[model samples]
Target chain A: MIKDSTIKRSKVTLSNKYKNIYEKRFSSPLKRRLAVLKASSSIVSLGKYVILFGLSFIILYPIIQQLAVALRAPEDINNPLVLWIPEKFSFKNFEISMIILDYWNAFKNTFKMSFIVMFLQLFSTSLAGYMLARLRFKGSGIIFALVMFTIIVPQTTIELPLKLSLTNFLNTGVNLLGKSTTLYLFAGLGMGLKSGIFIYLFRQFFRGVPEELEEAAYVDGASPIQVFYKIMLPNAKGVMITVAILAFVWQWNDSYFTSVFVTDANVTLQTLTTKMMGISGNIQSAISQAGVWQLFDQDVTKNPLFTSMILNTSGVIAMLPLLLMYVLLQKKLFTEGIERSGIVG
Target chain B: MISKLKNNISKNTKIKYANDDELLKIERNIKSKLAKYHEKCEKLSAKYIILAKRKQETNKGNVKRIINVSRQIQRINTKIQRLVANLNIVHEKKFIKRSIVYKIKKKFSEIPYNKQKIVWGIIFITPWALGFLLFFLPPILKSFWWSFNDVVPSGTKILVNFVGLKNYIELFTQYVIDNNNIFNVQILLFVQNLAIDLPIILIFSLFIAVLLNTKFKGHQIVKAIFFIPVIYNISIISSTMSKGFGLYLENNTTANILLTTQLTTFLMEIGIGGSFIDIVIGSVERIFMIVNYSGIQILLFIAALQSIPNQLYEAAKVEGATKYETFWKITIPMVTPILLTAAIYTIIDSFARAPIYRFLEYAVTESRYGLASSIAMSYFGINLIIILVVLGSLKGLVFYYDKR
Candidate 1:
């Protein structure tokens, strides 16, 4: 009985102590304000997480929906019972998409084109960026203004005339249209897809690097080229990686430039994006051409939904490689590249 | 001393000293060149001694290198001695006149170092400048010029007929596609939409970037997810998804729900006004597009935030400034430059994907290259005007932090 009483008394004392501390926290105006501020901050952080989660859900919703739609059997596309989860998961969609897209050939061409363009863009844009940032001279302001002009003007504005000119190509009687080399030429000259932005990014990044580093190299008898190679390039890894990934991805997903310059309707050379675009426009005819109609029943093949399902699958397949690359490189990209790219400064 | 020797030589040779100044210049140049050779010889000998010691210690393949280097040093020494003897003979008898090539070279070397840097700068920019001239400039001009002419594509060539302002007149007044869609209306709506969306996108992206910059739980994952839209092919994905799911959603029973419409009607019944509801519904409808479009902007903002030195925040903290105050005072001002960049990027990006592209495409498909060029040129003019306005307004607000 005595032990029980003592335990009860100790419990009451513990409650009393907590009450006293809680009362002390709000006993003064300053303390009360601080407590309220802390609570509000915590609430703000909670709200941030909620907003972030909601937005992330919105961002990822379509991709996940696409994946779900791609996974379902073609027969189940119109099945009212099926919603998110596929009742009969199959690779038939992927197989048919591969056939229609000429998956392997287009993948090879896209990868090669993107890779080469990425490097060429890096070389040309970085050199131009370095010159603009560190190698200022008379009329450089005009050059920079021109660079901004390039960025402002949409590619559509110049597409027709550019095509006409490139068709003749300096009056040399060389048809650069329907050729992959044209894409390479464009990239090597810093005229690739979004090359202006990459140049601007590099310029901002190089500007952020302390001039003392370059000055020291100059004092050591290093030429400007030597300084760029040994000093500036090493310090520019962040921007370079950022530009490389962006350039590669932009080129990979590019349809406008590729459609205009490289992939003529009569040409066999097609990147994945162009192939997807080409097939998507006439999926019904393309399916019959690929002989995918033999595997599916007439009812299924005739369904417009079935065509869309195939198109959706093709879209997923086209972006799957980029998704994989992003998943692999996102960690470094976010942690190293974006944080240090100085794209804004 | 060389000048005196040149004078004596000129007197002895009875040569008119019209170019005697050139002779003195040559002597001075030779002396400087000899000094450079002497310095090189010293450096090579130092290297030779180090290699010889290394050879003795390791007894390795450096002997061949040492012999070759010594021969090089000997050759340089002989060249130097012969130059010195030649200088003595010139001092006694003849004063050689400087050649035209040498004078030209000297003139080139006399260029200021800063001017030399300008030349190197031009060299550095040569590739891109050439690209701009060849690929960018001519096409831009030709397209602008083409807008004023009827361009017919002949075999690998374009046949141009100057059409004056006919294309522009048709485009502005009578150009109608699908029997109802006017180019003027479409472009106006586009600019109106841009005016609405630009600030919304900029503010939303800035908010998200600030939040992402904070150390929160799952920060890395959220950051990664935020950038996924950068790689997303918005046009293809949206078109495909709309084709499939838009149809499905229409057919589904859930399509009748219409929560937003219901809310709008209820608000109207209660008299909350129409324009406010329109804005709310409009932004709500475009939320997805806004998020997608702001991925790169968010990236830029996050970078700008990260680049803000920690000292400002710390100093603010020491001064007992609140978070809101610090954000406004330290963060916003610091990020203003990036804010301008993001704004310009946002404008250009949206313009590229604008619905006026359909009008341009319509023209292309119809083989009206002149009309297409006019459409493109007009769209560009509008874009440039908007950008200039943005720039002019933001010019005073963009605070460039001069780190130097």
Candidate 2:
């Protein structure tokens, strides 16, 4: 009886609170308008959540679908009932893909190349960016315009000729093609993949820094190079991270330049991206070469769907490292790097 | 006692005036040194000009002399500027003007602080400048030249024969690929598609960025998801997907028809016009490509949006300006510079992934280097023209918010 009375009392208070709010909302025109505004804002927020949820799904759909497809048993490739969830989860596809991709070897090569290129790109592009931003001289305007031109011109336009020059290497008769050194050369010279954009980013960022910081250093007997090392670089931690991440990511995913400069056919140097591209065109032969046909029946091996499943699995494994790295570094990348990149200014 | 104190103050004043005289003497010495360096620089520069004229006339034997003379002139100019900088600091009274290390540093600083910056700038850019001249400029010029010639790779060297405008005429007039696909038609279609896609991408990305910038639940996750496409190996995923499920779906003709044709018919039944429906359908079909292309653009726009100060919004609210008005007056104007960047990026990226790449690739595989270069050159020309047009038009609209 006491419990029932307390419940009744709480219900009465809730109803009384609602009644008071209703009465207050209707008490004045301003109160009514504010009540409507609050309701509309709630509605807007609801719509925003809906839109964002739907778009995020669209963005993530392929990755999610690929993961699901890759995890399913190979026998389920033809099972219409097994759409998303796997009936029997297995690692058979990943094993076959690793053989086809030469996963460990390619991963090692890609990591080394990307890491070294990242540092070289940082050094060259940041130095050039600082120069363009702080130091003015005759013809620097022309140089800046040329940088834009380099960004505009597609790499394909110069690929054939660049390859030719690399073959001869300035009449030294030393062929630099099909070697990792070519990529390092490009990076060290600020001509790596999308280096123009990185340079532009750094320039914009350095321009945003107050001039007085450098001036004070100068007045204290610091040279320009000393100022760059002591004052400017430490303060540009934000853009440095931004450019470093971009340079590393772009180099890691780069297939065109890698395929052109470092041909796997000649040098045995294969990055994951290049490896994936190589296998994608001839998956059936590659699958056969991996000797997977011995394990699976002719029926399963002959199916095109099985080949696609293998291809999809390979794609997943190839991008797995990048995805993992991104997950770990994304907080810093999003908050500090991109927000302070100063691309707009 | 008062008289004694006054005498002591006078003595101190006399010492202070004597110190002032010493400073003046130091300033005079520095000025004389600067004047002597200036005279030496003038003499060296006059000699440099004479040597340059002689080298141009003789075209031989004077290059080293010119370089040496120019180097001397640069060194003397730096010394003069350093002396002037020292003169400015000499009035500080605490500046050590006569230490042994100071004298050595004066000789080695080689330039004043300001002039040193210029030299360092050149030093900093040397790698890029050398790379441009050695790697970029030559290849570009050579390719442009080779486009007009018949280039053949013979052994380790390429042989060239002057073919005039034959490659160009052939590419434009009668180039056929894969038996029936015309090159001119493909290029035109690519350009047409680009024209349609660029604005859709820019507007969609900007809209998404604006929404993402607002506080909402799961905002971080959504933002992270949107950027996945930037890191995605898009070529591999798209190829694999099409090979796997997309092919399966395409083989089923009825399903394909049911989705797009049915929508079109329904829209037509409702009296929607034909061309508008085509655009709507086209965008719907290309929605995946659009999303992938706009990842970087969205990031750029988000950055641009975040950089705008909050005071503008607060002031607008206080003045009774609605959200729409604020978006137009404050948001749009503030992000216009990034808008230009996103537009250029969209155009260049689209052109990179354009189907014309296959044609160029085919030419390369066929060993027709001349034809490949022609295709590349023409494509680059169109790209430059489009970029120039966009830059010319958007130059006036990009509003840089200069904090200074």
Candidate 3:
């Protein structure tokens, strides 16, 4: 039910450089007054930019702090003089975290599940959307309303029943949560994380396309399915990219859904994070069992810094792929996709 | 016979076109006078051209002064003109825009033999609809049903004894386990916190959107910078808030950490009520988180703002409306639809990730499924009521420009 809401949510990249009333209005005036207004407004804008800069710093601060801590050696962390920049940089924490997190396995699992969900949701939501947008039938309104209701009803409300139902399905001596079956099933049904939003997006986008295009296809003897596949899908590339990236990002970052759906270890980054949280509960025991813990000269158990460093490193590792993705594809995802989305309120 | 016919046709033509001889003489006299007048006009134009050139030479020195005087008068007139204020807000009744889906549906319904089209519609929707019916709906209803049952887990089988409203009743009216008020307190506090967070998040996002929407240098970079928090996602916040630096220590002990800003300390020193201070500080501390959450809302607002035709603002300006008046009258009305959309999104987002949800997660972890379902159901019900009320009220305020 995340479909419509997801479209609404998908539309979240703030646009800059709007022509505000004051800026436009103040431009034309008596020469002296105009200059005064210009000077004052520039200064005011300078202040705003400074504030914006400070806010951005605040937003970036946690990641920066994590990076700093992740880089710091135990000794460097202990030093009172060191703050943001670590004096003795180290990759030891990362090394330990990689082994601790089972990075390769977790990465593979995360990618596998995310890609599956992404593709499933991509087809399901769009098809459903196109149907709703173009197809007229009895009870279609009710179906659309129900779809909206699903979006309204938070998943947590049904989390218990969903789990119970799954458990019931698996009661014939199979644990389904440990496999990718559960994720596929849920995601394929347009009930995946924000899948409803994707569907809604497709519907909204399809509706925005002039009826003449589809009608022409219909007059030319193309079936409804052909019209959708041949005409509609090609035109919906913007939304497709938008939804795909959003679904991927959400699935990748998703701890709750992954934690609930995939109970297995290393099934996704989220499940890995969930597992990490569990490990933190009995961290000392887990560490002592590991041979790497013994390699350290000092008793790592005595230091709070060591524990935090490990957590920070894991957090950094979990976030790195997303950060890299953002850096690489932000222009396409944020600018192009968003601009072409045409998502009305 | 041909000549006689021609003669009769000519006579008939002459009779039809009969005109007086005096009329022809007057027409000729007028033509001759027009030629004489043309010659006189040419001579007069030459004399006038010379006179005008002489007049321009004489008056060229005074022209600049007259122009300056007129400009001064115009400026005075502009200055004297009263700027009209939109003192009264116009509550115009607006109709919602008819979506193309509805239009197509109407058209399809009007056509005869639309069974094939209906089948195609059903075929397309069948997959998701089936998924919804089989998977989505049952779980929802099952959860609701479970809320009314006392579920027990046996070795291989589950025992679900029907306990009608006992869990919900015991949750609110009485404390079942050791007379503890934890459930009531937690639920109340969660609701209260939501009440606070909703308006704060909404107003903050709207304000920020307006600020960010303004043109400035490096705006693209600023937008990118602001959107960083959204990229970081919800887990980062939960991790940082719950278990980051000095987390093992008590709450007050973590105050000295770099992540903890001086605003909390300042508020504490000011001696505000303890709970109130905590709420305020919590909100302040998570301002970045709020900004993160508002990324989409800001975009929605910006998009809405962008869609507003420039002519409305220009028209407002021509009527001498102030920026404040223009914003209230034009911008706000134009953006209310998006405002509602964003608000609903914020409500859903916040409720979905609320502390109560965290509590429900804990209950699930502890294998208290029945109790968890009740909590989830109750939270869902309350939020649904709230969303309905909010949307209903806001619906009236939304001015659909398309209708206009």
Model 1 Cα RMSD, 1 decimal: 13.7
| Error at B387, model 2, angstroms | 1.1
lDDT of each: 0.87, 0.85, 0.72
Residue A7 miss distance in model 2 (angstroms): 18
* Preferred candidate (lDDT higher): 2 or 3: 2
Looking at model 3, residue B328 earns an lDDT score of 89
Native contact fraction, candidates in order: 0.72, 0.65, 0.55
> Model 2 Cα displacement at B150 (Å)?
2.4
TM-score of model 1 relative to the true fold? 0.83
TM-score of each candidate structure, all chains considered together? 0.83, 0.82, 0.73
Higher-DockQ candidate of 1 and 3: 1
Best by TM-score: 1
lDDT rank order:
1, 2, 3
Residue by residue across A1-345, what tens digits does model 2's lDDT show?
A: 999999977777777988878888977899998898889989988888887787787778779878887898888877777777789999999999999888899999999999999999999999989988898688888888888888899999999899888888998999898889988899999888888887887887788778889888877988788889898898888789878877888888888888888875224888888888888888889988988879987777777788888899999999999999999888888888777665555
Q: Give the CAPRI class of candidate 2.
A: medium
Q: Note the residue pairs that clash in candidate 1.
A: none
Off by over 4 Å in 1: A1-18, A264-266, B1-82, B85-116, B153-159, B249-259, B262-271
What DockQ, between 0 and 1, does each candidate earn? 0.60, 0.51, 0.27
**Range of the 10 consecutive residues with the lowest summed lDDT in candidate 1 chain A:** A261-270
Q: Is candidate 1 or candidate 3 better by lDDT?
A: 1
lDDT of 1 by residue, A179-255 (tens): 88988888998888988998899899888888889888777867666787899898888888889999999999888
